[model samples]
Target: MYNLKFLLLAIFLYSSCKANISITSIDSLISVTDDQLYENNVDYITQNAEKILKFSELNNYEKGKLYGNFFLGVTARMHGDNENMVRYTFAAEKLAKEYDDKYVLAFIFLQKATIYKEAGLYNSALNFINQGLTVSNSIQQYEKRNCAKGKLLVYKAICMSYLNPEWKQILRINLEAMKLLEKAGKPFGYDYNYLNVASTYETLGELDKAEFFYRKSLKVSTGNLKGMGYCNLAHLAFLHGRFEDATNYANTSLDYQENNSNKRYRDIAEIYQLLTKIYTETGNTAAAKKSEKLFEYYHNKENYTNELFKKKLLIQLLAKAELNQKDFEMEVSKKSRNLLVFSVISMVLIICLGMIYMKQVKSNRKTIEKNNEQLSELSQQINNSFSEVLELAKSDDPAFIPRFKEVYPVFYQNLLSRYPDLTIAQIRFCCLLRLNFSTKEVAHYHRLTIKGVQTRKTRLRKQLNIPSDADLNLWMMNLG
Candidate 1:
């Protein structure tokens, strides 16, 4: 009960006063690679991109322009805007040339090779990777050179798996890259390479070797890399009609992928394609279409993706609107509660002021009921002391005294603390009388007289805030 009250107090305290992020109109169709992912964290991509664009506009190499445009290109690729990817890359390359930085050229060429690789142009990808490698070698950047070689080998392996697509050739090149990367002690980027090789071997109908290297790849990779490696292994299992195993592995991959950035779009697209194939084989056209559409949605180039993104943006807008409506309702409810609380507080204050005015009038004048109430309280207290002294009636007792200053004080005093105007005391005192105190008894107990108590009681009744004599005691108690 205490916890619940605290929670309610917290909600009331926070309420509608909290700073709200009024979602501005999102032009999602035009806002490609738009909102910063994980808004609470530093929007590193956006910060750097702005720096780059600012520098480029002024024809300067300010800040991290090289990395900024590279990332922009990568994001454009995810949104399937191949034209934007190329454009961004071209801008970055121009900046790189301006600096005469081989590292920048190597990086840009690597990025371009990745673009070509995604488009299924093996030779084009190799040409770009080779250019990157040449630059890496000239700079004597062994780690980066190894990275370039690893990337080139992976591209060749992928092209081999798809084009002419000799599984043996794919396996051989990937294996060679694996050994080289390991020897160079630069295995970070090439973690997925071995898994792709194993998958290729599986396509060549070598399940034993496929299983072998898949496990090997998994041993070296963890987190999303491991998730993807398992996903590929699952694909092989799906090809072998192991649906249960496939689903299990795919689910693990998704679990990891969901928490991480969606950086592996092409790989995930392939995974979905495999799932689509499985669904098609099982005669599940709806499921197959969903997977196929998802694959095309992520894998295809600019124009088609832009059309799809427009449709998706409409759906997202509807969803965001629904969420905003719910947020508004929560806000409204919070405001209503604040109003109710303030309303109660205002009413209490008004009644208290009325009681205080009556007390003043009693000092200056007198009333018949004022005389009568003290007599009543006196009689009641005498009876109570004789009947039995309640523990609460003792002056030194915790319940008898005002807990604040540890002293005996008026019933009206406690009421004034809460209402500051003896707001409900007029009616609430009647309930006090029902605790078996007469007007005189109440006065003697609280240290007042028959006339004084009666005067106060009469004033209390007059000051009762509620209209129509609706038993203000009931109303106040109900607030608890």
Candidate 2:
């Protein structure tokens, strides 16, 4: 497959501008995974990943670096170290599963099973291996099938040898292990199976046959199986009373083993015991005593280490339980936080709705008050207009003033509030004038001259304490 980053770079450099370069980079990175399509597309996926790692510097490419981790994990496990393998492969598995990269997930899970097997976690190894098998079978990928099946058989063999209760089960599994290894053409696995078979034979007290298989295991194993093959051969040699051969093989195993590795203390103590027994048998009393002292030192050292390891394992298990408890608490806290956030959200929504309801209610009340005020004002205006129509119809009638004086008797009383000396005749004239009638109309209504009506209006105004300069007509209109 072509490098997705390079294609994106071509587009970025050749494009007119750099406005959407980041978005383009993300698309290109996503397209890298899209380019691979198969259940076991680990190679193309890895190649795509290498392209980004080689070219891209940003953490955006990090999400695609899982395949690299997967490969490194495989290498680490092949070198007989499961801790680093677990570290790398777990990260890779998490990333692959998140992306729904089925092929990558399956492959990494298969490798994760291998790591578990090396770590002696048989159940975990089988579980991971089965998961891989399920996914691979669903996709019908033969490569994944071969990988999972081969590793699973080896895991079964180890589990049977170490933990199986039935002797027939152990032998059946070891034989199946050899056949599976032969089918897979894995020399390393075959040599490991041979060593296990030799141990089984040794347990059965078949020394010569055990020695034959142990030597065969020693011959077939690669450089990677250094300490294992030699250690087993040296143990067999010691059992057979071949002290010099035992020492030679022990020395070779020690040379290959690391100082602080899992094999060191056991190897040291076992070699010391073998030397002590050999020196004692050879009549070398001084050498025997020195070897015995060394044996005691290494033996005590191994016992102390075993106790320390058990303590550490206890601490790890306790720490794991504590971590699980913390996780449970954290999950509870998160749920509580979610519920709290929901409550706050609900409260805010309720308050906002309440405020909105109050505002609407206040607005409705204002509208109702305004409508009532308008109705009252309209009723008053209608009453006043009807009274003016009635007065206009009665303006020409002489009984109108008499009728008005009778109907509105408080007119004189109101006039007296402003002028205590206001006369009855002046009030009548004032009442006729207040109707806005013409002087001629007022004369006809009151049976008087137009000049007389005007004179009477002036007299009425003066009695009401009117100013000579003020407009009576405007004053009456304002009063009305």
Cα distance off (Å), candidate 1, residue 323: 46
Per residue, candidate 2 scores C-alpha lDDT tens digits across 139-166 of: 4445435444554555555555555546
Off by over 4 Å in 2: 1-64, 71-86, 99-144, 162-164, 206-209, 222-224, 238-244, 258-263, 296-480
Which stretches in model 1 have alpha-carbon errors above 4 Å? Answer: 1-46, 52-59, 62-67, 78-81, 183-188, 219-228, 238-244, 254-480
- Per residue, candidate 1 scores C-alpha lDDT tens digits across 102-165 of 7657767877776655544456567777787677676566754565566656665765555566
TM-scores for all candidates: the values are: 0.43, 0.47
- Model 1 is weakest, by summed lDDT over 10 consecutive residues, at 21-30
In order, candidate lDDTs are: 0.58, 0.59
Error of 2 at 463 (Å): 99
Q: Top model by lDDT, which number?
A: 2
